[model samples]
Target: MYDVETRQRALALVAQGRSLNSVSKQTGISRAAIRSWQARPTPRLRRLAPCARCRPAPGAPDPADSYAYVLGLYLGDGCITRPPQHRTASLRITLDDAWPGVQQEAAAALRAVFPDNAIGWARKVGCHDLKVYSKHLTCLFPQHGPGKKHERPIALEAWQQTIVTAHPWEFIRGLIHSDGSRITNWTEKMSGGQRKRYEYPRYFFTNSSADIIALFTDALDRVGVEWKSAHQSRVARNISVSRKASVALMDLHVGPKH
Candidate 1:
């Protein structure tokens, strides 16, 4: 006898647009079994609570600070996948395995915004995928759509922009945690008749999406941080924060990943 949990898991994959054969193979359930289950509706053992965005008032998400951070992470590299047939959609944020603390903080932020939902972790090469499923993912992230984020036009809704404005640093921290990094570059300098090595730290954020880069820079501006930007390729660009004052502010709010 198959357990209900196993069946729901398979259905969730199908809802994500996975092929029947692939889902069957991954779940170790035959296509016939999956098809049979699909034909007949099985009630969900657990139903997720209504999303804040789905509420009648439809106000900004509660614990907006956490929402701001998660929004930054999502804009950097997060994705929401859902097939029209299913009500539930999944929100996935890719996190580096080297920084377990960042991963934990990300999970905490997600939970704060999405309390009463199940959060899971999937392992990938050198990174971990933090995922949660909900009916209102689209409502929460109006940005979800087909194709790559860079290929499509991305814009923030007024509500989201308001949250980012209120919690700019958290938003910046989230973006940096997902797609930004800090590095120290050193060069030899002639001082007092001797060659000495001088090291300086800088923060860089790279994204193919121009809108995302603009959003990051906007946050930096709010915090009085200066940045320099350059295009690395046709679709990708880098934003660098190298000024001593800017780097100092970033260090206080977002140091190198733990």
Candidate 2:
């Protein structure tokens, strides 16, 4: 049997665009063997690379903080689509046009995790979609599946949970960037026979998925940020962080999504 390292070396050579004949001459492996290795399943070949989710003793992705942040963004507003005819799949995250900084950060985060993947930008009606094409996006984000994220179950893998534990703020920031918001509300008060305006700043995270909401709030709880549940409408539920201390904490880490 060919050793694992031998197969990996042959596959890596083929990935580098070397012809099977040349790779065989260089590695002394037969062309048929190299072709068979190349024909192995996607995840089989993907295991040769470092993947926190797929590796035998998987660790956090390098730049695990960035991965945590992007994980939030993915849960909030990202989707992965793989075409039957295409070998590579696409990971896309939607960001509003108003927040250029958040868009740039999302793009940078995607690049940070997938350094070898090509990143692109596509414009939509009111937002821009950051597009990244990779063979390993599924390995990175195992939560990807059919249907709307809110319509299906979403849960973090153990390695992802580890990353979030290490970088809760970045995760919260990403969630806020995608579906949460920081807004100011004002009220009129009569004090000392005069009318005064009191303003309140709070953070709101809305998601249709209760599991996703729980994940956000669980992360908040871990960071000692207090939050409460509120229904903005009949169908929309929001996890609101309005406590003075909680807002302060969120402001320090997440702030406005500008």
Candidate 3:
């Protein structure tokens, strides 16, 4: 049996000159059911307000995979701006101009965190930026300290660490998708007494922040995806998964960029 409120709504729609068939189609109630509700002696014809789900709920949880992924992206390539008003802040992630999929993924991740806020994108000189503004954005990404991430003391909260622990692949995907890449390495070797060239796929994650790099490596360790430092300079730290097995695991989580 349908809820009394839903039956009343169907009867009300039919009373509003809507065809029974149309009301059935619009409300997902059968024409016969609507007719039956209309013929009832007391149909509880009270007006119904809009559904609660039509509006997004306030204060959504901040420790889910989507939130964790966006946090990873933020630590990698995102920036947060706080206005003097101190009421709202905007988070923006800049993706390479050639990588539209990364930009879309950032926007989708932001939408997941702030379902009610609008996600915007713009083209810069050599990159695309995805931006979203909300008071909650600052709360979600509290690591948005001053200057570069490397210059600041960046760290994740206990809840965020828990999320990363639970969904390491998503965190890795977000980090690599933003600041890392899947590249092919070529090598030559003597095979059958003849020189041969072979190319293999590997994943690279480079970041200015050592803390962020550590977080990435920690996630990789949890998932048993082996990685090692690949940086030649001290200014930035780069990590790579070059082993065939590790590269295959990274590929499973984060495929080639679109």
The TM-scores, one per candidate, come to 0.79, 0.79, 0.75
The predictions' CA RMSDs to the true structure, in order, are 10.5, 8.3, 9.2
Model 2 ranges off by over 4 Å: 1-49, 232-234
153-255: candidate 2 lDDT, tens digit per residue = 8898887888899899999998999998999988999999999999999899998888889899999999999888887666667988898998999888888
Q: Give me candidate 2's TM-score against the actual structure.
A: 0.79
By TM-score, is 1 or 2 better? 1
- The local lDDT score (0 to 100) that residue 42 gets in candidate 3 is 41
Off by over 4 Å in 1: 1-49, 83-87
lDDT of 2 at 21: 97
lDDT of 1: 0.90
Model 3, 1-258: lDDT tens digits are: 787778767777877899998998998888887776666524135343222223255332543788778877888888998878767788889889788777777788787777666688877899978988776555567697778889988888776777888888888888987898999999999999999999999889898888898999999999998888886487888998999899888878889877
Residue-pair clashes per candidate, as listed?
Answer: 0, 0, 0
Alpha-carbon runs more than 4 Å astray in model 3:
1-63, 83-87
Q: Give the higher-TM-score candidate: 1 or 3.
A: 1
Question: How many times do residue backbones clash in model 2?
Answer: 0
lDDT for 106 in candidate 3 is 76
